[model samples]
Target: MILLLLLLLPAPALSAPGRTRATIPGDVPVVVEANHLLRKGEGTLVASGAVLVTRGNDTLRAHQAWYDPRSGELRAEGGETEARVMARVDEGEGPLAIEAGQVTRLGSGRLRASGAVHLTRGQDTLQAHEAEYDPASGEVQAWGGESRARVTARLAGETPLTVEAGRVTRVAAGVVRAFEGVVVTSDEETLRAEQAEYDPQGGELTATGAVTLEAPQGRVQGERVVYNLRTRVIAGGEVAAAVPAPDPEADVTYHLRGQSIRGAWKGEPGSGLPQEIVLERGRFTTCESPRPHFSVDAREIVLRPGQRVVGKGVGVSLFGTRLLTLPRIAVDLSGEKDAPGLFPRLSLGQPDTVGLRSDWRGTLPLGGAASGYAVLSARHLFRIGAGIDRFGSVPFGLRAGYKEEASSRFVSGLTLTVLPAFTFYLPAAWSPDGPLQVGLERMPPSARLYSGDIEGERWAPGRRYRLIASGCAGRFSEHPTEVTANRLSFSGALEVRPFGVLPRVQVGGALRGRVGYYSTGTRYGVVSPELSLYWEPSRRDRLRLDWRHQIARGTTPFFFDRIDAERSLVLEWRNRTPRRALALKAELDADNGGLYAWEIGYSRRLECLQPGIVLSQRGGDFGIGFTLEIPGLSTGF
Candidate 1:
């Protein structure tokens, strides 16, 4: 019975130079084949002459191999004239293939390969002199040994990448770690560091130790950097970068240094430079001088290329000297030749009555929905005036001190706007020269409502008519003690452009009627008709004439509601171009001296500067003003 069982067994094991199968008690069965096979000490098998070994999903082929069934370990070596030993292991993350001069499988399920090792899985490849592979986790680690062969890998993802380092390790399916002189290259950016961790699946590369990233747009260097391959956003600490101009035609670059930085690219994801970047404890400048001609240092800075730069807790320096410190500041970089951003302005002039005067205007963002502007003037006549305006949903404006030859304690107004042409204003004024005491003076709170025209397109095509209705109620006075009346008034104005034949010439007319009732039992009615002729001879020149006639049927005690002018005519000529502007205006009014008043103003716009002059004559009183403005820095308030 024993002899028959022996004969029934496979003949290959018994035959020399054939295949043998070794079954372990708790492991997968091992199969070995070669031209020559021999039994060594303690269940150890030696195979030579084109040895092939298979255990589970792992397959290895070499010229000679040694397998110990007791320990479940295998080692293979290549022959002198033959190719190196090669092994392949099938795992969850594709098949791992390794080629080396010698390969060893330890009992702990780890494979060690040396001597010009080359590993591949899917589209990823690794080259090193020594490497270790974990079949269960599909992790491959390569390092330089005595031969000092650097490890290199090529990863094929959305962006093809190449990594070279002294040591490289595959931590996960798409995660790689590199150390010691690491360089990662892709189409969009190149990165260098002493150590880096890259996850191609997540499109993130984190590099540390004097890291540097260079892209087509600019370059960044820092102690550490984490870059998104997909978004092309770079974030790091102790960062310094040179960002190119957002305008492609411009050849300017900005330098930034910060404790920490985070930014993003604009326009399309892959193309274009960074549109916005933010830095903490940052210094930013466009000057390339070693010390920089001008720079801004701030607690926090936000840079929007080609638009503007905003800074908080900022200190501005010029020529290494600190010039100013501000809570917040914004600088515009739109490259507009004429319409510059808000800047502090100082002008010296002489008014009709006020002596030598100096005026200053500036704009400030009040944060949130409100931005505030102020105009302050000081006169030699011991009169100081200030006007402040806030723009937002509920705009508030205030003028204090003497203005227009009138001494005003304060004149303040608040406007409430409702959608679709409804506006209400709480108008109040208190003047020392008025009949009323120094208290709250309601200058007739008013409400204005309009329709039949688009808000910003009143002069656009298609709109031919507009209707405006306004009402006010309260005390009214043009001067102190001129009238003692509490007035309620309602007015309506209708404007129509009935002519459509001449596109370049616009002939429009408006009729306005007003009715008022006074608390002192005085009622008045007034009607006003106005005609306007506007001719645009060219894109840069226009001529306009306006004739207004007013008639009164009844009179009110309040001069504020009384219309004194029975007839008025105004003619204006304006010439405007990209580089210069000229304006001429003449007015004739009856019932108010019947004097013909005229004014002429001209301004020339240079690349970065503008100069203007205005001369006016009103009833023998002549006035003149000369102004010099920096186009990008003048606030023209």
Candidate 2:
């Protein structure tokens, strides 16, 4: 009961194993008994018996007890039995067993237990003849055992991140401050220090006084360190670090003995490899001798971890001989990628037969999360007819776009494009073969377009229902003809998600009403309804099928344009998680006279670039194309 009361109090969820062996209802009546009972008349109630208190997953037992509620004091005495006074508290992973010959509680939070006092939580154990505890602050102090105080804890992770210390303090919930001869260890790493403090919740650790951390990648010894567990960012002073080459076969560890080091490391999440790092006021070398055969004394050195070693204000020595000097240089440590700079693209028949296009792309982060992003790209296709006289912009020019979303509820986007199209003809002098083809030419002019959209979605009462409203507007203009037009469209949709109707299956359907109007006074109304079903065929494969039907009504001349109702069924399937991902999509029963189209694509992701192949068929046209994703900010080669 005492253990349950302590857990029920505001504290971290350190419950042992989360199982209630035997429980007593809190609202039930309580009966106290003993061979002899006495009341001090005004203050204390004393009883003697084989006492037992139980609540939920916690229990306390003793041979005798006394309580002074007005003074907020409780005491329990143990007789010469096999089990003395003890309290067992269960936390999800295991039970904490605390015992003492005599136990005393002051107020609601303070406790003093003496005579062979011991505490055990999970695999960790602490022993002391005397101990004091403050439950509100999770502070514990102990002395006795004819020796000194000590603490040990098991850290659960990919490896065993356990620690042992001469003395430990719960500085605060989720935080532990330990002193005197502390040793932290894991399967692949170990850190020995004189003192250390750590926050288990944040995975942050700080240590001081002759600290040395060793792992598979390298080793570091320093006077102090502040390391973030999640980000793998570390800052240490009076530091000596050994960074290994990305390739193990190199059999060389680069040593950076420096005054300080700061960097955000990159490994496979928790692999403990420093993918990136930086050091200040250091001497770096590849030699493993007691004294480096040669080293570079630098003001700063940045490790593009595994990729390159960049240095500034660097001086090199060959066996203590001042051999060379470099103001700045970046040594290549890794190979190249389809980079972010200008890349020459070759297409078989895009804008023309065997066309060459120059493409440049870049991406930048606007802020936090995945939504605030701005991407810019420019591409120019080089095509030829003979005797080109006019100097004009190339085909498919430039685009700048940005998008942001507030989670899944609201989204906003804007994009501007420089779209180019031209028809070419040979001049009289250029058409040497025939005069009939001299004047045959068609020019459609150039155009630019801008578009924006805003959307908001909300759930109605139950999670199965959703309401969405969105609006979009766009404008385009022809340069030479000065012909301009604008369009605006708004839609409202109600979605029904009855996903769990079948096990391991998800299904949804929605009805949408849309209205679109153009600046030229042309208007269209659409009644579109869609139904979709998705199933997980395997642990790593998914298939989705959808049926979409649209009813469109508008006025138009048959000779100018024909407005037809459209209905289509689409199906898509993909692998859930793979080194290389593949997807297939098919559309059936479409608007342009009952035709079907589909596409299949495969993609492979690299650190700097992703390459893809797409095979698509639309109506009667089929195409197979190769593409490269070079749209992100470079991680500096």
Model 2 agreement with the true structure over 352-431: per-residue lDDT tens digits: 22333332222223421110112222222222111111323211112222111111101111112222212221221212
- Steric clash count of candidate 1: 0
Best by TM-score: 1
lDDT of each: 0.64, 0.54
Error of 1 at 201 (Å): 5.8
lDDT of 1: 0.64
Summarize candidate 1's per-residue lDDT along 1-637 as a digit string, tens digits.
0000000111123325345444434457777878778887687888887777777666788899988877778999998976788787766666677888999999888999988888877666888888888766667788877666788888887977888999988864567889989999998778899999987778899999999888766788999999887776778999998777665544457778999998884335656544688899999887556687667899998888777778889998756888779888777665543232333344444332223333332354573221222234454223332323343323232222222332111211111111112222223322344332222222111111111111111333444555545454444333333444566667666667546448788787878787878778878988888888989989778899888898888767644344535798888998865457688998877556454578788888543345777777654346566655433223221
Give the runs in model 1 whose Cα sits over 4 Å from its true position: 1-26, 38-46, 68-72, 136-138, 145-148, 157-160, 172-174, 200-202, 231-233, 265-274, 288-290, 339-637
TM-score of each: 0.54, 0.42
- All models, RMSD in angstroms: 13.4, 20.1
